[model samples]
Target: MDRALELAARGPAHGPNPRVGCVILAPATPGIPGRTVLGEGWHRGAGTPHAEVAALADARARGHDTRGATAVVTLEPCHHTGRTGPCTRALLDAGITDVVHALADPGVTSGGGADHLRAHGVHVTAGPRSAAALDLVHTWHHAVTTGRPWITLKTATSLDGRVAASDGTSQWITGPQARAHAHAIRAQVDAIAVTTGTALADDPALTARTPTGTLAPHQPLRVVIGHRDLPADHRLLHDGPPPLHLRTHDVGDVLAALHHHEIRHLLVEGGPALAGALLAADVVDELHAYIAPVLLGDGPPAIPPYGITTLATAPRWHTTTTHRLGDDILLIARRTATHPDPDTEEA
Candidate 1:
């Protein structure tokens, strides 16, 4: 199970598919209680061979007999044919006898894999090392279950929750460590989004850069949300990849378009209005705030008031995690279980 978890962790940082790992163990020989590991493999992304099939192929290449072998996998073997063939069929064809899976596949079309394996007479053990497997595909699960991308609102603010000074001079608000951390977050998302206000004000490239300022090898798609066209010479247009222009103010419309593009995780680096709109639409899945130890009493608010007039009506978050990065503090928060609308707030 630990090997399976490790292989699952090697998957891409961001993509539309879930990360999965698999290990094949030959039956225990004689008095030895432990089985010999015959092969190991992990899924890279969509359109790739599944972990089970990869491991089975590796075992075959090494001249290891797979008959009566146990397949230990992080997630349940998929039973539906997607970009690749069904993993359940692969396991059966490989002559795998027993299966140990961490998490059940939650996908609507690819779920119930454990049942199919049992129907085929394969002994199955579910939920072995489940917590780690679930964390491996946290956002992917949310996207598959909700039919929309998981949105994370990321912001750099002052101690008093100010995003900029009174004059709108917001450069270098956080130290190098905090900025680097933010860039790392950008690298792990399918797309980076901002509003027209930010695009015009900052002219941000929206491309993830390494700590040394070079562009990252795998860049997220850059998107600007609003009804107006950007300036002819906007830097984002000439960056690593051309920016995707979404001419709309409706958060639902923006999310729908991204969903169609198969974006699983979206990182919103805000200007206030767009953040307010996402919050008001109640589509935000997580908040990543980097708060520096400074006060800008007269600057623009980090988030504009969106009908949050009374204390009782203010938004609340749960499971906040705090980390100190240089002179800044990174605060991550997720919506509580009691929060309305697990799926679009039932509008």
Candidate 2:
């Protein structure tokens, strides 16, 4: 599971393909009951090597024979051919006999890796820690299958779900811990996007600046939605990393532009209107709501204008994970398979 989680961390950095982690487990003798982790490998950098191949090499280096060993992975290996050879071939070559996976690869180019392995006399089991693994690469997976990047609507709001004070003073609604966690999310995704309205209103840096005063060298691309021209002095645009100016009227166009940029994962750090627009367009794939325990009844609502008509009409999502960051509750939700009416416009 640790290997799987670590593998997921590789995705945004490696474009097009989701990062994977693998571990080879060798059964212990009578003296040692639990299986020993013989070797572990993660996709290190862009175009390096696949996770399974790396893990096998590690096992060999450690003098651990992988013949008949059990391999645990975060996602199913690739069955079809790609830039790298099929992972199924590598596993077979490594003499791995058993496989455990968290989730199946949803890509058309690599869907049946597990089936291919089973056909080749490998025992495969799936769905153990699958949800957690999927959560990590949810955006990437969504993009591969849907032809657009997955959108995560993230906001820091008060206990009453207000994003700002009544007078529009919205700085630091959540504590330090929640802000730190948000930065981590920004680092993981391909782009940190917001609307031009948000850019004008907040003038946020949008770059993932860590608490240690260190900036992520390859910070996510900052994108501003909408066709409105940004001010020459826009803080987000003038920062160290240049922001992408996307002139689009609709959320779908924004998503298409992001896809063109090879941004498989997008974090929407909002100003409500953008969030509501994405949700209304049914383009949002996941939501990360940071609910701080405070109340400001007259403040701006977490989401903007369009009142979600009904629970049924609302885009269906599944709660993937909920963690506590300081006094804030971080809730993560993924889009469901069903799509409501794509033709309907938001009120």
Candidate 3:
């Protein structure tokens, strides 16, 4: 399972399909405590062979007799055929006797593989390193399950939660290390988004770059929100991937638009207005804050109030990690529990 996950990370960071990996193990012998590894493979991207099939093909190419082998995979082997044949069929054809997988596919079109495999008489075991496996593809799974884009909100603030000083200068709220770490976050997602007010005020290029200031191999799409138009001399108009203008005030609309653009994970770096709106809409999946040691008591807060009047009404988040980046402290968290279902709520 560990090797499968490592292989899964080798696939593209953004694509229509979730990254998956598979490893085939030769049947156990009388004296051997563990089976020998036959082959390993991972799903490259859309329109490619799935991890199970890829691993099977690799085993055959190596002249290994895979009869009664065990298949260990990061994700459940897919049961249905889309761009490729069913991985269940491939595993059966390869004479795989047992299967072990991490997470169950939540996708409507790609789920139910475990049950299908079990019904066909293959021994299936689930839940090995499931949490870690989910973390690798959480954004993809969320997008698929909800039919919308997954949002990761990033903020840089002072100890007082102020985003800027009285002069409206926020260029150095956090130290260089925290800023560099934020850029690394920008490089991993499908898009980096900000409101038009932020774009105009900061004039940020929003390009992820190496420590040497060169562009990273994976550049996220630059997205600007709000109904306002960008100036002709704007840096966003001329930097990195072309800027996508989402002229809307509705948070749901913004996510729907991004979803159509193949944006599974969107990193939002907008200001208070947009942040508060996302919070009120309950659409933010992850919240990342780089808190500096300085106090800025007079400027706008990093997040403004958006109708939360009590503790019960306020959003809940669970801390995932806390790291000290140079002089700043970074807080990484995910939403703990969403609002109760409308049908289940009391009057």
Candidate 4:
């Protein structure tokens, strides 16, 4: 299960599909009494073979006997076919007799996989490192459950919590390494969004670039959301694909519109009002903040007032990771769960 989880993380950071991995263990034999690894694979992205299928193919290509093998998968085998055939069918075809998975897929279109496998007489075991597996695809899971893109608000601020100085000169708040890391993050998600005020003022090109300043192969859709028009010569309008100009200040409307366009993961590069609006609406899922060592006393706060007059109403998050980037520290936190998981409850 730990190996499967590690493989799952090798998939794209964020996309329309959830990250998944699979490992095939051969049945006990005379020479190898314990389980021996036959093959291993991880899902790449959309329009590609799923994890189970990939692992099975790997075993087949290596001339390994897959008959009666057990499949260890990070996610439950999907039963419904979309771009490819069902993974459950693939496993059954490969002569897999036993199956173990970390988490059941929550998607309505491609769910109920464990039951299908059991109904077909395959021995099944579940809940091995389930929490770790869920965390692997939590953003995609949240997006699937809520029917909207999951957001991660990225901000660079001083130790005192200010984004820019009083003069509005906000360039280079974080060091070079932190900015490079931020660009790497932008390369993973489907879209990077900001408000019109930010668009007009910063005129950010918003392209995911390499450390050498070259454009990365994967670039996010640059988006500006607000009820204001940007100038024609702005780099955002001409840099990459045409910007997704969402002409509205309504946070719900903005998210719904982005969802309509099939944006599964959204990275918000903010000024203040836009981030605060999302915070007030409680739509933001993750917070990615880069804290610089310097403290600017007379600068704008990274996030302005939202509506937490009392301490109890304040937004709380669970810190997922922290890493040092040059002189800055990147802190990532995620929203606390509001409801219990049915699978966990069942377990």
Q: Please provide, for model 1 over 57-175, each residue's C-alpha lDDT reduced to its tens digit, 9 standing for 90 to 100.
A: 89988999999999999999999997899999999998999999998898889998899999999999998789889899988888888888899999899999998899989888899
lDDT per residue (tens digit) for residues 1-347 in model 4: 88889889999876678899999999988875578899999999889999999999999888898989999999989999888999999999989999999998888889989999999999999889989998888778877778889999999999999999999888888999999999999988999998999999888999999999999878988889988888989998766689999998888889889887768899999869999999999998899999999989987898999998975557678899999998899999989964333253453
Better of 3 and 4 by TM-score: 4
Judged by lDDT against the true structure, how good is candidate 2? 0.82
Cα lDDT, all candidates: 0.89, 0.82, 0.89, 0.90
TM-score for each of the candidates: 0.93, 0.75, 0.88, 0.89
Query: Candidate 4: where are CA atoms >4 Å away?
Result: 30-32, 337-347
RMSD of 4: 5.8
* lDDT preference between candidates 2 and 3, better one: 3
Off by over 4 Å in 3: 12-14, 30-32, 81-85, 119-121, 338-347
**TM-score between candidate 1 and the true structure:** 0.93
C-alpha positional error of residue 72 in candidate 2 after TM-score superposition, expressed in Å: 3.6
